[model samples]
Target: MAESTAPPVRITSFGYGHCRGGLRIPRAHLVLDLRTHFRDPHVAPELRHMTARDQEVRDAVLSTPGISELVEATAAAVRAYQAGPTTELVTVAVGCTGGRHRAPTVALAVARALRLAHDWQAVTVIDRDIERSVIAR
Candidate 1:
């Protein structure tokens, strides 16, 4: 299959706590806040210390009730943006409470969805806050 000729896309996962002290969340054309709508794995002792890189964490987040649908919706949104009349890069910011679980998992899912749906060649996914110390709720 030929690679998509759409503009490049960048997806970032971040924690809301990291926005404290004058820090700003990454700018994006679309931002999905998973803090409230989704479950947090941090509250689970078994997954508390795990990042999205861990299969357990990814499974926990991906199994949430609305997550798969949201991933598809977000991928659709990115496709819409790409189909528009612009050549600028499309950025998507996925944020959760601490960025250790839900956000990064969803960001990665969205990247995969976009790749499969559109055969995109330049989608980049970044875990902006996954390595940071977990924020105490």
Candidate 2:
């Protein structure tokens, strides 16, 4: 059978604090919360205003002890879902306190890992709250 070329998975990053009112978490096959397990870059004055798109913010988040392992594990889970009998889009939702830091950074990392592993030719990552105003904790 010829391999399908459509992207098989989507990853979204959100901030739990942004869910007030009508904003909602994206529905997904897997939802990983980093609010407790990972450190927040927003705590640092320098990183507070930056999004995951910034290299320094990316560096800080990726340097956290367990972030790399979590990214690999999430990719593995996506692989498991793809192995299922039905061919469907797999969605992964990653959430952190403000969504501008840890969550988006990790989501991008997971996409990178999956691509490096040749698990998928394309992976979509949406930074749901990366542009939103920083949440004051």
Candidate number of the best TM-score: 1
Range of the 10 consecutive residues with the lowest summed lDDT in candidate 1: 113-122
Predicted candidate 1 versus true structure: per-residue lDDT over 101-132, tens digit per residue: 99999999999998888766699999989999
RMSD of each: 1.0, 2.1
Listed in order, each prediction's TM-score against the native is: 0.96, 0.93
- Each model's C-alpha lDDT? 0.92, 0.89
Q: What is the TM-score (0 to 1) of candidate 1?
A: 0.96
> How well is each residue in 1-137 modelled by candidate 2, as lDDT tens digits?
34555448899999999998999988999999999988888889998999999999999999999999999999999888877886778899999988999999999999998887764566889999999999877
Error of 1 at 78 (Å): 0.5
How many pairs of residues collide in model 2? 0
Clashing pairs in 2: none
The superposed Cα distance between candidate 1 and the true structure at residue 6, in angstroms, equals 0.7
- How does residue 95 of candidate 1 score in lDDT? 96
Displacement of the residue 100 alpha carbon in candidate 1, Å: 1.0
